[model samples]
Target: MSYQLTHPSLQHDRRILLSITKWLLIVGVSQAVQIRLSASERKRLRKIARGHRSPVREKLRAQIVGDAARGLPNTVIAHRCGVVEDTVRKWRGRFAADRLEGLKDLPRSGRPPSFTPVQVVEVKALACQIPADADVPLARWSCPELARHVVAAGVVESISTSTLRRWLTADAIKPWQYRSWIFPRDPDFAAKAGRVLDLYAGIWEGESLGVDEYVISSDEKTSIQARCRCHPSLPPGTARMMRINHDYERGGVLAYLAAYDIEGARVFGRCEPSTGIEPFMALVEQVMTQEPYVSAKRVFWVVDNGSSHRGKKAIERLTKRFSNAVMVHTPVHASWLNQIEIYFSVVQRKVVTPNDFTDLAEVEDRLLTFENRYNATARPFRWKFTRNDLDDLLTRIDRHQAAEPALTEAA
Candidate 1:
């Protein structure tokens, strides 16, 4: 979009004009200055001149023109307007020459752009490309580096980094910043994800779930390392954070498998030696053998594409073991859809952050004890993402994927 730039100095020009009035008076020579206006034009000028919100320069110009039309001399109008005599004469001459349009500021030719149109376009386009593509040994583009490359590529004879910066900033082009993204690889991504989302929202397959039914999000946090700090960790004191030594002795690693009830907010988990079908089935037995799950109307188990519980076999296995249990697998690489990950994140931040465990036994105790303490006060995660949000996200992904080839070609 193109917009006209206004001169700000004109807003306060009356003050400047008044300040230099004495100098102009000493050197001022009188000239016959007269202007004639139609009755409507005179009314318009009077309205602009008396308006409180009129531009200062415009108000002064209107007042000068009105006085001149009243047969006043240049000096008298100048003094009345608090401007130099030459200022009055200039407006009077302009009004006679071009009427009201003459009162507006003429278009200004701003400082000419340093680079040619093609050079600027090429520079911005170059910013969109990988630096390595041009045989330049760079992972990203900085202003000075881009300027150097643009010159070397014969797009421009010479360019300053600041000039290049200004051009890129105008177009909001920043080559120094980057982000990582991936296309969804699961063929049944939306359908599978929507099913899990529906369970969280208390609707299973378009039907409201009964009070006795339950949705469980299960996941395994593997390789939780017990790194014993060489020196003991200090407790946080006033104005100081708790510190952990970087150097550490490798105590051991263990897997924490968890199943989080979405509605009831209860977490049933155990510290296992490793993750597999047998360990996972053991966890299922632990949860299903309990009072409510054993007698509930139905229990939906939400898990990811892990070997422990995957494919139709895992679903059949769960159903065979417990008639009430139903297995729901999240789409491949979509473990984030599982609410158990949220509980795992809390464990990571609160318990395993410093990782100052003495041994694998201490790790197991901490994990199991924290689980009990957590379930005492835990509330179900407030999952807000729904089918509508998923649809919007998929729409955006579709648009991005559709544009990728064109973007690649442009690059």
Candidate 2:
């Protein structure tokens, strides 16, 4: 036993000696590696280390460099920063070699892109065009369908739908979605739209409208149905939604003709079995025969091209019937410019959407009653879109049209 030195305490002492030797070797290696920074570099490192907004990795690198600059050993820096000694050593070496730039990750190696720039352009161009234009049966491009079409057209040999989707996402391009739009086909679209916008601004032919003059936007809400629910509508309760019966009995349909005073914030409306010259004229009489309008200097009526009031004949008929009334027709397909449409949309939401009336009479009552309540509190819509905005919009459309041929040729 004496010869083998078999005491347990002696064995433990030997293990302690080995551990101490290993630590000494590591400390010696770390001490031998020194990092020095220039004055500007030291200042930058200090700022980055103390900055609250600096990225975590950048802050850590800055701390390592700052500690190294102060001649702290790598082990001490690692302990202070709660990182491995190797991490401290690596960044220290990087800073000493390439300064700040070396702290950033190097360019990574990967497979080259599957699609070339021309192929990408082709795909995006196809996405913008309608499917019919491209002679495809589909209405719109699905990502997979687009990928197949690209391959079939020899734009590329093969491509993944996911890869194409990723590329499209990066460029904010989506071929699968669409919004309805119409070109202002009316050659006189600019002139006509400008007059309406000006009237809203209280100007007429470069002159401010007189206080006695009134502007009215008139339109018809057609085929409003009265649907009697098979069951009564359930009122909303705690943690429960208001339930409405999807199935209902047909209670009949009615048309609502309404005139909205653009400046006066008044509404005149009536229910009719159908919309035609006679019914529309009744609404006109309802508004024009009233006290202020009856004696006003001018009553400008803005209307759209419907069978009830279409073209020059309708204009002559309205002006002749009431000498003080002037009919202004909005461009075809441009009812959005009328303020009265806004009021009708509100009525549809508040009065007619649920469609729970027992008969058409109830529908009429609710609409008329709501109109009175609305007029009591309604203010003139703050219509800010002006002739200048209309001009800018037209200019953009012209530029887009001018560019279309080039895009088509390229495609």
Candidate 3:
């Protein structure tokens, strides 16, 4: 029997076949959207994908492109890389459109800066100056105070302290903090300080020191008080810190004299009721009477300008007592350069801090015991600062001083 062309059953069947074909074409096109990288592109992508230091986003993009180039389907690429299917598809399409440049983040639009550049410069300049120079009563500039002052001075119409703080933080400027420093007032600072630095480096008079010659850094830690706590100290336990009593009884005070061998890492310390010419002389005797030092070709004693050992008279005395001992004094107010001060700081932190001694005798015993303990493992300090560093520092200081006149004139 011949079928009619306009039959309802045939027409319905035709519509169904057309719809199936359309859906199949769509699926084929979607799956055919694949990435094909060139030789150079492939090398770059592989390098980025394998790099441990590549940026996270760049690495992800590179990995996506790499997998896509390997004929991975979008779903498989997403699954393997722990990313969403949409993300994989998006990056794949972007690479196909613009190659590697399309993987970078586009410039974002955010809020404009609240303060103008001029206002920022003014604020920073004020921060660089002392509060006294500005005739303000504040000793230093807090963020809030600085903001208010800038507004009052018409630098900015208005500003928030938090915003000001953010600006200062970006430039690493903190005006509210103070660091203690002193200028080199002694005229012979360079000559004297250079000599000490040279000694630490095993150099003297432009020649390497002899093997038998020794360098010693000596200093006195005075007024160490013994504090007997009213309540017993609590030892640390699970999830608790060691408790030390705030109230303490003053047992007594004493002075500690220590001498450190800059080259050998040896320490000799003595506890005395007080520090003076007499006590310091005894410490010298204790060290000078020992081996190696006793028969050494030369022993350079680096000391600070303390009253106990100061001036030509003290040098004369030390040299007269031990002919091999050469007294070398650090520049005035420059005790921080002394290596013995470093040992004293260690003693303060480890032995004297949070002091809970029962009596003066306990304090002395602890200090002496720690000296021996330190010497057992002690090594010479790695003194890196040399004459070159000193010269550079002084040059910078001179330049800063020379600029003051111009800065004042401009103001």
The Cα local distance difference test for each model comes to 0.90, 0.90, 0.92
lDDT at residue 94 of model 1 (Cα atoms): 92
Error of 3 at 164 (Å): 2.5
Cα RMSD of all models vs. native, in order, equals 13.8, 7.8, 6.2
Best by TM-score: 3
Best-to-worst lDDT order: 3, 2, 1
Candidate 3 positional error at 21, Å: 8.0
- Per-residue lDDT tens digits for candidate 1, residues 290-408, read 97999999999999999999999999999999999999989898888999999999999999887898999999999999999999999878888999999999999999889999978
TM-score per candidate, chains pooled: 0.66, 0.71, 0.79
Candidate 1's C-alpha lDDT?
0.90
Screening candidate 1 with a backbone cut-off below 3 angstroms (N, C-alpha, C), the clashing residue pairs are none
Kindly give the number of clashing pairs for every candidate. 0, 0, 0
- Candidate 3 lDDT by residue in tens digits, 1-411: 677869888999999999999898679557745788899999998889889999988999999988888887777888998999889988988888889998887788878977788889899999878888898898999998899998898999998988889889999999999899887888999999999999988899899999999999999999999999999999999999989999999999999999999888999999999999999999999999999999999999999999999999999999999999999999999998899999899999999988899999999999999988999999988888899999998998899999999988997
Screening candidate 2 with a backbone cut-off below 3 angstroms (N, C-alpha, C), the clashing residue pairs are: none
